[model samples]
Target: MKRTTLSERALVLAPHGRDAPIAASMLAESGIDAQVCTGLPHLIEELDAGAAFVVVTEEAIASADLHPLSDWLEDQEEWSDLPFVLLTSRGGGLERNPAARRHLEVLGNVTFLERPFHPTTLISLARSALRGRCRQYEARARLIALRDSENRFRTLFDTMDEGFCVIEFLDGPHGPASDYVHVQANAAYERHAGIPNVVGQRLRDMVPDEADAWVEMYRRVLMTGEPIRFEQELVATRRHLELAAFRVEPAERREVAVIFQDVTARKRAESELRELNETLERRVQDAVAEREAALAQLHEAQKLETLGQLTGGVAHDINNLLTPITGALDLLSRRHADSDPRSARLFEGALQSAERAKILVSRLLGFARRQALETRAIDVSSTLEGMRDLIASSTGSGIELRLVPSPGLPAAQADPNQLELAVLNLCVNARDAMDGGGVLTIAAEQAVVGPGDAGALRPGAYVRISVVDTGAGMDEATLAKAVEPFFSTKGIGKGTGLGLSMVHGLAAQLGGAFMLSSALGDGTRADLYLPVAQAAADPAPVGGNDAIRPVKPLTLLLVDDEDLVRAGTAEMLRDLGHVVHEASGGAQALAKLGPDHKFDAVVTDYMMPQMNGVELAGRIAARDPGLPLLVVTGYAGGNLDVGLPQLAKPFRQADIAAAIERLVHGEKVVRLRPRRDANSAA
Candidate 1:
């Protein structure tokens, strides 16, 4: 419950007579609430509680102790000047009566009324006191509101992050506007300006050297009543400050308020950056020629990168076209093995040509860095000896060919097919370098590479196969770019300029390096280093009908976008005694797999429209995770991370049967398990 406030009412003190009652009744008639007190002490108590004004007779306090009442009048608030109407006997006015003068001293704002006065006169005086009391109440309310607003502003001003101060222009021994005094400042002033107790200090005293500039800047704001913002350095403190100054309202006062933040760190950083840029500009001007050469090399590299991407794409399409043709020829060769001699020879030639085409496609993919290498340990000496006939035929009979292999050489780890291609490219390059009859030496030996080797090879055992030719060699500049794609020295139409680059790529892929050393008129030597294998060499598989066939026939789903590729694969599966179901693409394959249909395994081409093989495998796995999946693709760079087996394109009937057999028997098959990404998983 809220306590009642009686500040608006009047207090009456007429203890000995009807004066108090009569005065209270009169004020009540005029719409005023009055409280009647028995004595001066009671009236003082009522005043403490609250009252707008008081009405008291002169005799009530003439002989009594008036100290309490006097103290109350002195203790009133700044906004309060309580009015008092004294009811005195006749001739009781302050000028005529000595006792009335005492009351006047005690009650500062008092009016004296004689007892012989009319009732109208008493009522009129009482109302006049109440009117003055009302004005005091209004003043008290305004003072309270002003104090609350000041409190809020004080809180905000002191808590703000920026330094704030009010400065008043002063006319000192100097001239007008020559100095200023800080009238008020917040806590942050010391933090930002590095000055303490500045509220009463003059600008000239605090910063004697810098005061003039600050005074001039603020003086303009005062005169024009405009705000100014600027960043300036305080030389004495070695600090930079961003400040805004505005003239205070009622410009006659000639005062300005300043708000500032320290920006020393930002200013220093900008200065350092400017100096560094100037140094860079000088260095760039000095190295213009060298930079141009490097830029030319970069542009050539970028072109080769683009061509590699195009080559990979074209290789994918070519592999798809070759798949059916290779499969058909292999099946036909087997069916007509005992045919007439001429027909058999013709078939053998056509199959050899197709095998050559496949090798060419593989080399293209290798140059594009998209071919998945099937690396294994192999005897380096045996491999070199096997390629001896081919190398001799390519170099022509005019050139002398020699093979030098160290006895009991360790095996090296590499992809056999890619390894052959790389060596062939190196030998052919050596033959081209020899314009006349020259000797070509092919040497292989086991060597240990140390940490400080020139090839940047890791410290390990390796087989270094060097192809040294005694022929007209290249100069240093030409040799430096010998391994760069499209940098051939041969006539434009005679070379594709990718042989050395392909060799370099293959070496790097197999964890090795290719280095060329040559000088003008001297011979060129190409070294191909390969890592030594830790395990024994993997024995080459012997082809046989029983080894390639599955134990039992399986129901298989064959999916491919290309009609010929799909049909050829389906026919191969049927020839292996498996019931085959075919579909043009992933969506059609999904539509064909209904609740009534069941298959032991799924084989889908990787790159297709609408949906790819990985996605189809995922949908099928969601329905039945136990179902085995086989992804057949011509594109070797696809992300096939669905935990399925993969078979490369241009596979024969035996390769398909072997893949299906492994899938059915739950055996791990060799595959390209590319890295999984967000899109492939989804």
Candidate 2:
């Protein structure tokens, strides 16, 4: 919609040539562009291009047929009104002439000047006509802008997805303006509301029952000019409508514009969802109650489990105490009935039962006191290598055993016998963890320890002995208590739970620390830290039972807190052809030793009511520096820290004889000195 401007060209339709030139000159001087035309045909050409005004003579208008000009003027649009300035003679009968009057009527906006008119009068009339033409062009531009705005609005209104309608309030004879007519509607209004041909119709005529409420809503909007939004059901179509109504053209008539949508399905779904939520809440409460009952039952089951563990530990301790009794009885039975050798097999079976029972008892006391340790310097690498066969047999065929000792592993200051037992215990635990077959690795490496490195062990050098198992590992809770006495994760009777505990006790007693680490599925690793020995490891004979040289029988002192064990040991010493002096404890033994008595050796129990064996031996050695001393202990309990020969309880007669003979004959008498440092042996 583009507007056309007033043309600069003013067509002069005068018939005389001189008059046309003069008129052109006058227009040019007046700053108006003019074109002189000879005839009506030429005038038509100029008018076709565009024109501001037309000047014509009375004769030209009277003689000529102005139908072409008439047709051009009649074809003009509403915004166009081309002005014409007619030049007439004085007393000209142009207005009376029928043809001129006809032409004047066709040319709608025209000005006339009589003959002998002043030049200024003609110029002023011509300029006034041009000014009116310019105003017409301005009107045309406004019309075009209005048309474009209407077209854009119409496109937007028709393309909207929501229903839209413009309603004009219609007043009745009395009362309020209660009726509203749909003056305009978009395409979506009929589709969404399910009502067609609703425009140009009164609300009361279309839906008599629903009309009043809707008319009231429209009246409120028109009166107050306030926008409102509400959801309501239309009874005529059974549709739920979400509508927003706002007053439009506030300065003009009362008209309301409505934008609405169909939401019946959404409303139905909301009702169903509310019912479902209520049902779920009840079910959740029921589930919570059931869970509480289950938790109570679980707590009762845990109580029974704890009782079973206590029973197992008690049974194990009883078995340990009975082991020595069973062995002694078996030996006595063999000695009495050796003539009838058939009775020996029955005694042997009894011994086997006792051995089995002992193993069960020992498992329950896994972290209990271990036997006395004879601490010495030993190569950790060689120690592990030597125990390969024993470890393999104990772990069974299901486990693959590997003894991987790192090159240049230093000798560790610990008892070789105790270290071997600790490694075996770890391997056995690893075997049980792997229900299926897996690899058990025993490795040794040299480690340097600075201050605050290994717990409770003085900073220096160390030998790290690691036992790793490719088996089911432990969780954090289980690993935290792995080294606690009798805290087994295995089922009752499956394990004594003393494996890690005993290893931990052994390392600590040997002036080192024990560390265990595991993850749920990543298997377990146990590390035994033993301080590095200052001297090279002694490679001693494996066994020297047959190599003992018989020594002459000598007087010996025997000491024990237990009356029965002391009597039995004294009787054994007398049977071996040695004179024996018996004392109840370290106090009595020290009293018996005086300047008048001569004794070849002193044998005493490590744990007594007062002045135990290690203390007694130290005192005896102080009194008689050359006197040989030996310690016998049932359970050392980490108190055997004296550099003296030790004999573990439940030893055979041959074992006692060998120890006494070695000390009496000057074979291997332990050096007694003002001790450099107390022994770290247990």
Candidate 3:
């Protein structure tokens, strides 16, 4: 590798006539690059710019009163010797002149050279002078660097954000106990300690109590030879400070240096923050109270709106049933076949009409109160397929409806009839949105929202079905209160506005979120979510049981307060070939079933004042271990609490048969009828 090292110049500043080049040549031969400066004025700039040496001639140096260069040379380190070469024609005579000798005597290191000398003698004097100058350069560079470094250290200490201070040992009885005297302190440190003119003072004299604390701290540090840090608050000033101290080597002895920073403002800010938090907590409590009151008002409004929707659903379904009946009756009346006397066929038609009327009555009761839910694992897609014709007919010819039902949708646990009603409400809402003529898109898709979602949805997969309308859309403000009870969009007689609120409440009870998105001129979309049912066991296929032998008939108790319903129901039971016992109400029925009579099944209505179906079922279940009790009613409220089976009213005769068979067999049914769950499976 190529040799590389930095070579320094040795400059010997002297007058032009003194043969500086000749002197430099001698030093060059001695392996020192020496140059004599032309003037004293340029010495500072040259030396600062990294020049090495300085030399002066005797005639110029002795007569030169301005000793700027000499003073600068004296400030150098002790190892430095700034050499000066003197040229003398009469050497001994020069020494004899008292004034000249006095000046020369003071300049001790300079060599005297007699003129008319040999090159060897002249070269030796110049080389010796240059050698001394080299020593001066080394000393000056090191000391000056150290002096400049002190200013750097002071600048950093003063400019730091944290207050800093240095304390030195002092000479006194109190000082012996104290850590050190306060020798240096930054501006912030002085203000915090409340000590003025802090430098070069005894710590104990300035701050007596603080001095005692420092004594205990310093003693530990000296004994352990380790640094210590502590945070404390001043009792008098209530100022918080962080104190740090360590052992350091002083010029002549070992001393401990301590630095303390004030943290009072930070502590005060934290206190204020805690106070703000308390204020915020009070505000939150007030808000919660207001929210509870609002919810109470909303619940009252919902009760009234629910009554309105029941009336509307009743009116709508009755109107639909009338179309077929009225048509058949009109045809019969137009024929005028009196002699034929169509009694049997007319009685059958009357039965169908009575069945329709019964359905309307049960639906009315369902709306007046809550209804008993007949839950089952239903194929919602299939049910939707059944309603395809009804939905199309329900909407006007002007509205274009696109029913995009998912073909392979998962099975949802729901009451098929109730779910049908809820879906009909959605379709009605969509039709109302498209007043003129527009496409209403109802699409179903599977979705998953996990934790960290903005809505904070539960971690599970859900079926999301959206009813999208290309019609007059709602604004953001309207969308926010869209699901509020009794919040109507249509004018006075046109709507009760319970459509969305009911949808929301029902969905919430089913453990799901009800979401609505709409923008002016864009569209309105409602997203319905429902939790998925985990298939804990394989799905059991419930096949038609025509091949299996029927179980032996046992006594069946049929109970109802309504005379027409009991009589009509008894006729239907006798037609099915069963031993039946009829009772007017729950109390009369219980007296008949008392000990002597053991019934295979008990079918009763839920909303009886004397003895409710639930209460009767509970009494019976408490009394008998294995008797199967089937609760038949239109009013089932909340969740089911017992093992008794439930069946909603307004059913086909076939519906009664299927339910009784299932209860007798003790088949597992879905909990409460989940209309919203249908949306999930779809």
The candidate 2 region of ten consecutive residues with least summed lDDT is 541-550
Badly placed stretches (over 4 Å) of model 1 are 1-294, 338-352, 450-455, 541-547, 637-639, 668-682
C-alpha TM-scores of all predictions: 0.54, 0.37, 0.41
lDDT-sorted candidate list, best first: 1, 2, 3
After superposition, which runs of candidate 3 have C-alpha atoms over 4 Å from their true positions? 1-386, 405-419, 450-452, 531-559, 585-631, 637-682
Candidate 2 residue lDDT tens string, 75-141: 7886676777777654324535445455557775665566655455567667766766675666566
Give the C-alpha miss distance for residue 534 in model 3, angstroms.
4.4
578-669: candidate 1 lDDT, tens digit per residue:
89998997778888788978998889998776577887877776577678888887767333454668888888888788877787785864
| Residue 524 in model 1: lDDT | 92
lDDT of 3 by residue, 432-522 (tens): 8777878877776667887867673587776666778887889987888889867878885467776777677656655666788888888
Which TM-score value belongs to model 1? 0.54
Which has the greatest lDDT? 1
Question: What does candidate 3 score in Cα RMSD to the true structure?
Answer: 46.4
**How does model 3 fare in lDDT?**
0.58
Instruction: Report every candidate's CA lDDT.
Output: 0.77, 0.71, 0.58
